[model samples]
Target chain A: MTAELPLQDASLVQWKPNRDRAKLIQMIVKVISGGFAAVSILTTIGIIGTLIIETAAFFSEVPIWNFLTDAKWTPLFSTQQFGIFVLISATVMIAFLSILVALPLGLLSAICLSEYASPKIRQILKPILEVLAGVPTVVYGFFALLTVTPVLQFIIEQLQIILPFIPDLKIFNALSAALVMGIMITPMVASLSEDAIYAVPQRLRDGAYALGATKRETVTAVVLPASLSGIVASIILAISRAVGETMIVSLAAGANPVLGFNPFNSVMTMTAFIANTVKGEAPHGTTAYFTLYAVGTTLFLMTLALNIFSFWFVRRFREKYD
Target chain B: MDVNEPTGGLEQSPEFVQDLEGRYRLDAIFEFATWAATAIAIGVLAWLLISVLIDGLGTLDWQFITSFPSRKAERAGILPALQGTILLMVVVATFSFPLGVGAAIYLEEFATDNWFTRVVEILIGNLAGVPSIIYGLLGLTVFLRLFSDITQGPTILSGGLTLTLLILPVVIVATRESLRAVPDSTRLAGFALGANRWQVVWSHVLPAAMPGVMTGMILALSRAIGDTATLLVTGAAAFIPFSPDGFLSRYTALPIQIYNWASRPQAEFHNLAASGIIVLMAVLLIMNTTAVVLRNKFQQRS
Candidate 1:
């Protein structure tokens, strides 16, 4: 309201003719943006809604008992088996195998990055790890099929001579897919756990050192314990990633719907099953079409559980270092 | 921590010396283990890059990049897939960038911290984590049912819309982060000077946050380019012999084409898949480098 005001448009008078118009603009912008934010919420609802509708159609024909109980998954055959457990077991087998490979390596690297490396070293190293995650799942799938499997088979061949009890490994087997998946997911685990580990209070480490504990002892006993929730969340996130992994397993795991846990055998995961179903032109409303949604619903629930729990841990139990 | 360490070395008792030896050994082993893990990860990356380049290098001719699919693997090329990929990126960017940025701006600047804000935050977080394949299903069911007349069923528009939905959370989250980085004092200063919320955000905050938002958008589009599963479910054809003529025309992307080619039993197709991969990675590298440079420039400025 004064001539000395710093703003360019300022005047001695408070009369700006379009000020009311600006107020109207503000309301429109806010309301319109509120609608835009709702789109994401709508997307989640659409996913669940579509899956539930189609899954219901699927259940009407096959009966829920058959889906929940049957042990075979040959939907294309005249016999028509729809065993979801077979798909789940294979999915779990790969997820378990990948987690086994990823968890220790990822956690250790995270510890190293946070505890041992300087800022300069971490700057160089963290980007290199991110590059691994940046590579597409499609490329990783190609790598598994082309490079990892042959390498795995060669190793198994060598190992077979020393340990004859090792079964004959198929070219397209769970081991190769799991190995590549673990590599693919390592960055996810490491970056996330690094945040958790880095958040641990420095005073805690100083206290451990004061007690004459070694660096190893301090990291394991003090930092890891303090950041346990975050570490577990990272693992859960990695597991979800592995479970939702489609291309790697689809390309390398050889889509045989088997129920056993042999890593050397060819098996189909739930994601692979959904993808394989879509490769063909299944007519709408057919058993084949409905199968995609049912399988998708199952996969959705699995990843949703993992994500929900991980998010809960991160929000609820993260150690704040002030 | 070392700065905070005690001034003198530990007392020179025999027990202390013994403990020091044990601690030193353990420290060496821990260091070795962590280094070895990093080494293994780096080694795998090196091997993957080398192998893809080696397999693809011989086939990287102008003819291979610009021709259509052929029965003979030697004659087949990635023209349609590449074109489709570019077209889809354009479509997805056009749809998602504005929508995502708007959402982010609204959430960060306009919404008061309340239950609605909290729900929106949690919902977006969950969306960010959903698998790509599920989005494919959503596209198939929702777009096919509602927007087929507009999107032209199973075409590039449909596939592009699928990716748009899939990457929305990624963009929103990125924009929100960059928007958050624009210090609140700037917004307060604008408000104190009588600018409205929209004018303050538009003229001040977004301009400052442009580089970050642009980087996020480009990276998200690059990610959409390599997606195979969602588009496959959205009915991106495995073999679109012709380049996409429009958003409604038949289309296939580099990743889907590579998946198709690689899955074939023939050895030659596998090599073509590798070459396609090299092209895809090159596209991504260019985009990624641009983002990195933009971010570096922004970093230098601030």
Candidate 2:
């Protein structure tokens, strides 16, 4: 055993010192990189913890029942009422209207790009769509408030003469914001849906063509159904984005938190409420201040649910043609 | 070409001819509708750009670029906001790029198949989908309040840190994708050369993935530059008459300045807002173009 130990020591002595140094450096790199990876996990914890702690503080002052069931939201005023539904209704309306605009346009654009457009045309159109996607939401806010709102008001005025039932469009109405937000999200929907459509195998298309199906019929029937999960996932993601959208709504959708369904009315969305209120000097620990976190918790939960469902739906229902 | 003709030796019924014509008509209509949808989408973008350019070009003189925000519309400029935005980009890039790239390298190159690694990957994906505003809430609580002693309230440092967290997931994902694209043959070759794992990654793998890493970094920075909500929630000042002198100094960004100006009731301020948008869009265009160019160059080389 002693002779074997000496032989092992002799082998160890032959090992270069630089190799140990290299190994030490590698270990340090691994530790550093691992720490960096942990930051994201820590950040998630930070976001959830921050929301919970502040939301708990908010609920301590105002009963959860008042927050949920109240008809009014006037936390900024002396006569404070906390009606979460008032903000949620407006948020949902805008998101719904925005989706109404985005779905048809986005899906059609995806169909055009994926199934119809030549490769050259696809190359040209894709970047144009990307440019649309890349525009800042704050810029969309500017466009909505300044340009789209005026045009919408003019159209509403002309429509009033014929229909007579249309309400007067407020200068700051939900329709204008919804329309612009729809435009903002259209590119995302188009791109994601295009990916889904493109993933539908060529054999499927060939099979449909062999069976005498026209391009439109095949797309509507076969391709769309085959890629339904991905398309739905994209739509859900867009909805989540619209729900979380802040700048456009805050700038265009007015600051009145009313519980109603009229798209023509000036309304406040959840994100807009948080944004506008934070702009004011609501000192820390105040009920008004805590309201931001409470509202944020609601927004976070909503988007989280949507995001989770989107990914889940994609995994659950993804059609494996292979 | 006549629908009534039995060209293929099969008898053509009148109903069949009519149905074929109807299908062709429907196909043409659907085609036109798709084109129209694409047109409308592009048209909105064109209109936005044209209107902003028409209103902003006259205001985007050298004087406007150099001067600071003022109460008077005639003399007001975006110098402070522009500087703050540039500075904030620097801070965000410096911090997020290294951390994101490192995390990506760990996950892609070093991590073994384990529950912790799986959880980290999943968490990163979900974090990317979280709203920018929630990150703002996080910044308000953690950086502005919890770390107030270090951050000195809502300064550029706090805002930059908030944005860093917001975009880290994007960067990590992008970097991981690029690293994954680097063929395993490269690593194998390095290993065959008796190089250690870190040496192989540092010398060979990382250089190959640098182009994509840079593209992702630029895109993340562009997102950070245009982000107003997070900064607003982090208490970025509306009227910073002076430029941000340091990381801890109070600051305002281009988007925040634009929001402030656009929200006003005055037409002159709206014009100023358009000019700010012009500047902001210009910056974004340059970054995006550079990213595209880099990606194309790398793709061609490979």
Candidate 3:
């Protein structure tokens, strides 16, 4: 609170440093502590450096245009196409599906836990939902491939009879991966939105009720609008999560890299592309090996953009009720 | 506003009252939707837990736990993966806990709220959101490449260091929260007794905050254990038939191994993957339960 001072305090203070010796020791302590804090900055630098150098090398060999415009990504084949979107389009499709499920379920659940539930009920349930988040993405991947895909296949088969136009469903389809990805991200959405929901002042609700608003009307008209920015931030962050999610998509979403609109068709995501491509040893400095860094850079940029926006929203727009 | 004379003044007709009923019914529907939403989230968790158990419990045996990984599904074990995971956790916990706690202490207690500190804080926040796979790339190029002789390229050490980085931001955030929970009066009291800032923080604040810090540490390790994309990208050996010998040795963790098995076309491998998940979940459960208990203790104390 007193940090506004230009110099050290001249006024009488209750506890003052005894001498220069004490001041020296304090300075040393501060430097060491600050040094530790600077490690994160060092980490950021290292990450950027690694991504840039390798991505540069990859881009030098494969022009930037092909990385964007080329529809086919066959880095391993004799006839190669360096189109990155072969992976991105599929990634976007799966992420889209995940957000579709996550938004409604996550937001409503957050509202439910924050608004509708009694304190006792909320205390019991919130932790359980958190545990859902704690379940590993790898385990979710296993669930998607082993359990969800088969179920989707069965349902698709039944649907195909009526809508014979339905394409043959692949076992490693994007739909199953997207579904479980939605579930995996649900806690992120629910917990974040719950915080935003909880932060909406009780007085707002009380005021609405005094104005003869029903429970639904009070929540929708007062609490929801008040916490709109926080809720939006939660969703954008959740999208950031879904976009970067790897194991679930890699395991369930097939490695085919088809640039198609069909969710039932097997397609590879950028993460999946990076993951599945590495099982076979590509010689060092080869284009195939360098592709990893290229994809890594793309994935990093996408997430970084989303995260920066999310953080901006959270910091700038959140209403301070107090 | 004479309420008894409502028919003459403010009384609602049957039509107005019916409109009110419509809103009340909608409110009731809204409540039920919220309840149903909560139930659906819970229901998914229940189904996930039960299905894994029903499928996995049969294969989770002593041999499965003790023996090394094998080509045959029946003989395959998690010994190498378990050892690697433990080793990785050891590296992460040992190295990161101090760094993270120190960073937190620095941010909370020592540093002035300057532009540099603000930048550091913002960087940490962004780092937390960066995808795990990018960290793997960083490890590959930085630790594994720059310090090639040290890490010996894509071994347990590289993976461990990568994980250390991955969990650092989280550990910092957790430690800061715990430190903040230590009331200011404690610091004032320590200084009143002629304790220096470092002394007060080291002697009083840290000890008071240790349980919450430990809880955060365990949760961080659990998170590191579940990670796969990073390990895979860092070249975790998918088929290490023998146990890893040291930090420099090629190794696999539980998640990587599970992913390896799950990706295989054979039906039996899927079952084996399920069994591996059971083990991973068991460990996670213990760690999380401990964390929860410690957190509750910390909450009670404060």
Candidate 4:
């Protein structure tokens, strides 16, 4: 059984979608990309908008000068002096303490991981550190509250006998939160610093070794210095993370915003204040609701500046291996 | 200047004598410190896991998993919280996956070496560094407050949207890296085969980049799961007795519920919080492991 074939028309061109289809796709891609970029920019703009609107409302109700200079930070109970310095102080205090702990531990861990530890060991340990990072900050909050606070209380009590200057530190204060936050951000700094250190070429290490330098000398003089920018950036990023941590400080550090720098005392951070007051279901146009936005704006600017600065520094100082 | 050197040259000195008394004491100390650091790192992980495991092991049961929270704390279950968390992840993934992939594709395939695109890239990178709490603020103000009357602010939708923002940068970075790893020749081949630009991207490029995208999605979802602050601010109700009814329904995630329970004065509540931690950890591990395995399989296949 033979099938009959139809004759082709010689005059007509074969039907094909115009090459403009590519251009059409390109246009679609362009729109999509523009949309993605716009979404990001919009988020940043949204932050600014919220901050300005809320802060303006707050300033109108309670003078901006008072919010800046007043020492007190009680909005829930009274309309008097709603200064945010206390909150800023608390945030700074905790951040400073966190950086204190994180800088040493994180830098040292990075050093050990990059310069000292075997690759096999790093393979096993890096993931463990990441897992630590992966543990919910809420879990860290509990750890701070349930475990570390009691331990601190016990230590402070024990130390009081030997040292009269211990100030009778409370367990749930800036110190504990800082310590926990430090622990939380250490893995991040360490991992990134290790990457930076490793990026320093092998020739630098070999050069140091060839000059009769010990392994420690090679790391300290050659690798560490070479990776300094990265290490700094890593530390800065860690500090930013530490500053921005919420649940840990909010849960562990007591919610009393004070303008003092005593690590022993309970102090509320900017994040904690935002978290607490925002939860109270404030009247929409009220000063309290606007204060959340103001605080958020402050936090946003602080973090944004840190990130931009760190990225710039890292990029500028990054060693060109090739 | 030569502390390790003996009265004669250190090379001529007895190896045992040098070993016993050496400046490498600092080296030993350094090694010991490194080991200590490793031990401490491991110890913290163990401490966290054990704290949760010891407290929650017996209480974690089918009933606990399936039941709703009761006014009577003892009779309460995490069913509502668990369900909310799962639903929130679904919603977050729904938004994040496409947005992340699209951003990644544009940066990798379509973007040229231009100032505007560079600025966009920088902005995305900067956004990634913004704190999750800040994202919470953004979410609360934009998604919740702006649409509160419309969507009744603090719904699962708002929370999910906030989390999508939190994870978007991470997903973009991962997806872009994966897409960049794909060879340029494949796109050329597709184009040569009479494929349109979209066809080349959607058909050839994306399939090659799928594993990476999936891996990034897993990571982004994992991050979303662990995040509580943004969700909390976005209006995850402190106590939800039942799973959310819809997108606009109030929600409570495991982390938030855990944070709530842990903050309470009751010891039983603390135990429940620990149990929640165990559940959270398990979920995170599963998600990450799956991503890693999938990535490995894809790498092998490719």
- In order, the candidates keep a fraction of the true contacts of 0.73, 0.82, 0.76, 0.49
Off by over 4 Å in 1: A1-15, B1-18
Off by over 4 Å in 2: A1-17, B1-18
lDDT of 2 by residue, A1-322 (tens): 3456653687777866488889999999999999999999999999999999999999999999999999998999999999999999999999999999999999999999998899999999999999999899999999999999999999989999999998999989999999999999999899999999999999998999898899888989899999999999999999999999999999999999999889999999999998999999689978999999999999999999999999999999999986
TM of each candidate vs. truth: 0.95, 0.95, 0.94, 0.92
TM-score of chain A of each: 0.94, 0.95, 0.91, 0.90
Error of 1 at B297 (Å): 1.6
Question: What DockQ does candidate 3 have relative to the true complex?
Answer: 0.69
Candidate 1, residues A7-100, lDDT tens digits: the string is 5545636665688888899899999888889898899899999999999999999989999999899887889999999999999999999998
**C-alpha positional error of residue A86 in candidate 2 after TM-score superposition, expressed in Å:** 0.3
lDDT string, candidate 3, B86-177, tens digits: 88888888889888999999999988889989999999999999999888878878887788899999899899999999999999999999
Q: How do the candidates rank by DockQ, highest first?
A: 2, 1, 3, 4
The full ranking of all candidates by TM-score, starting with the best, is 2, 1, 3, 4
Model 2 CA lDDT for position A225: 98
Model 2 agreement with the true structure over B97-142: per-residue lDDT tens digits: 8999999999999999998799999999899889899999999999
For A109-171, candidate 4 gives per-residue lDDT tens digits of 877877778899888888888888888899889888888888888898899889867886675
Cα lDDT of model 3 by residue, A193-257, tens digit: 99999988899999999978898999899998999888999899989999899999999998998
Question: What TM value does chain B of candidate 2 have?
Answer: 0.94
Quote the positional error of residue B176 for candidate 2 in Å: 0.7
